[model samples]
Target: MTYRGRFAPTPSGDLHRGSLLTAVASYLDARQADGAWHLRIDDIDPPREVPGAADRIQQQLAAHALHWDGSVQYQSQRHDAYAAAVDMLLASGHAFYCALSRRQLADLGGRHPGPAVAVSPASHSATNTNPNPNTDCAIRLAVPDTPICFTDRLQGRQCLSLGEADGAFVIRRRDKLYAYQLACALDDADQGMTHILRGADLMDSTLRQVHVLDCLGRTRPDYGHLPVLTDSDGNKLSKSAGAAALSPDTSANLYGALRLLALDPPADLAGAPCAEQLAWAIPQWQPARLNNTLTFGVADAP
Candidate 1:
């Protein structure tokens, strides 16, 4: 299959150094392979989206000469697609309705401890269960007991087992919103994405997405996770963490992002135009050079 990659960003805020680094890395990977690079606005959660975050993200990418190959896709407009996928999973018994509230799950934490938690199958098969649920109820995937393993292009071999007590992972929230795992898997398949280059912070999400792909009988793309940019306190730079918005100094921003990616761009290119710097750096882009190290102090970029 032809190489097809994407840079998917949640439109919670403007692009910061961390996000810029991901965009640059993904862009280079696609361009270096002479493949198609697509941009996806993950705007599924309206409560987290900013008014102009999506447009600003596009503008920032343009400023850095990171132009995508096709029209941008917004997750918000594809609710019907997500709904259909959920329905298919439900009908096939790959997923089930979840009436347990967040507080209820928290209360069951002592009974089910781990990074992954879910209600037991027996509990779901108990009396008063509603398989075909209403909007207020969440929908969870019935993950198999087998270990989910995949060789990450950057992080090396990775594995995780979803325990029986961990119950099920929600595919749809109680508020009637599709989960990231479900949406991302379906979207990648629908878009025919061949590869996924994103931040390492989402390493855990890979297993979940892979499971979703298996349930949907869709192909799983190759994944490469870049190092995540963090703050002084070692917290990952995120909109929730109040990462400052990126400045319009496209050249400096691109140079800084390249350095963070472990790409040694020429010092003289600091003052060069964004296009010139990208033109010089694209041929030199090396994803393997990144050592899976979290870059601290990225919020202090000049």
Candidate 2:
């Protein structure tokens, strides 16, 4: 099958060096395989989104010559699809309404306080017997005791026991917003994505997504997590951490991102154009070279 990959970025801020690294890695992987690469704007949470961040992100990618395969998809406009997924999970007895508040769940320990079981949707109304009459309900997936395991192309074998902390994970928030875990899983399946290339900072989320895919009876895509860029203090570089936005100099930024990925480019290519640099680096983009490394330091320039 032809490999299909995506770079889904939240429109909370402009593209930082860390974000650029992930985008470049995903772009190279898809191009190397002669597969289609897609761009997805994860703009579900309106309150957190910046006004023009999504457009800026697209401009940055274009500046670097990393164009997408087709029209970009925005999660905010795909609510109908996400809703259908939730309905399907509920009907199949994989998820149910949860009236438990965050405080109540925390009091019972952050993880699932009770035994894990397959709960029917009918049980949602029966189990929620709180007398306060003021609690909103969120949708949660029933996690089993079985381990969720997948062999990441870069990280190798990995496993997570969903029953540990918070036995059941929320797929929809009490405020009626769809959770990232649910929306992302459904989008990937719907878009026919065959591979996921992202940063190691999201490594833990892999299991939760796999569980969602299993519940929906969909095929789980292959995953590859590249090393996360970190600040001098060892914290992961992120929009939350206030990482500086990348400059529009595509050649320099591309070189810098490639260096972070441990893909050493020729010294002479430092002054080359973005497209030329990418052309030279595509054949040398060996993901295996990033094996076992989870984080790397950011440099001053490309």
Candidate 3:
């Protein structure tokens, strides 16, 4: 299989130092393997999306010289594909309509119905037999009771039971918008992505996507998670947390990102051009240098 990888960013805000770190690491990994690196703008959730964030993200990447292969993919335009996958899962008995509201589920016990809350085909409401685009209930995958396990390249072995962790998780919302898990899983598999290297914060969502792929009978991708960059206060750097956006004018930020990855970039490369810095760092990319640490603080950058 071709070593295809991707950097998928949700366009809720501009790329921050933390996000730029992810982009750098992902780009290096794909380049080292002589693979194709793809960029995907995850803008499916309109309620959370910024008006011009998607285009700004592309410009930011271009400014950093982190060019991607092929035309950029936008999740907002893939509704038809998502709907078809949901329909297939429904028809094949892999997913079901869940009319239980959050309050209702919580009333059952917890905010989510645990492993014991498996819904049977006979339990489906009359409308479940033929749900339409206007269906009001959420669509959830009927996850198996077994634990989903996979070894991460950095975080090591991971095993989590989907049913116990999140129960029958939602793939489509009540408002007709497709859930992130569904679209993400489908896109990775459909795009022929063979390897995925992303932040540790998203590690938990991997199994959910794995299960989704299994239900759709698609090939699973190899997964790895880089350590998440935290702020001085130890909180994860995020747009919601008001993390500073990246400035592409200087390669100092890129060099700092390399150090954050534990690459220990040469002193001469500190203020060098982005292309020159990348030329030296690409072959020297060592993901294992993170030493399985889960968080890197802004203050810790040298």
- Report the C-alpha displacement of residue 126, candidate 2, in angstroms: 13
Please count the clashing residue pairs in each candidate, in the order shown: 4, 4, 0
- Total clashes for model 2: 4
Better of 1 and 3 by TM-score: 3
Lowest summed-lDDT stretch of 10 residues in model 2? 117-126
Which segments of model 3 are wrong by more than 4 Å? Answer: 111-135
RMSD of 2: 3.6
Query: Tens digit of lDDT per residue, candidate 3, span 40-155?
Result: 99988999988899999999888877999999999989999999999999899888776665656665554344323433333432222433334457888877878998999888
lDDT of each: 0.82, 0.84, 0.85
TM-score of each: 0.90, 0.92, 0.92
The collision pairs in model 1 are 117-166, 118-166, 118-167, 119-167
What digit string (tens of lDDT, one per residue) describes model 1 on residues 1-302? 79999999999999988888889989888888889999999998899999999999999899888999979999999999999999999899888776665556667662223223333334532234453464356788876777888998887887877644364687899889999999999999999999999988888788889999999999989998877887778788898889988888888889898777667888899989988887887789877777555454645444
Kindly report which residue stretches of model 2 are placed more than 4 angstroms away from their true locations once superposed: 113-135, 299-302
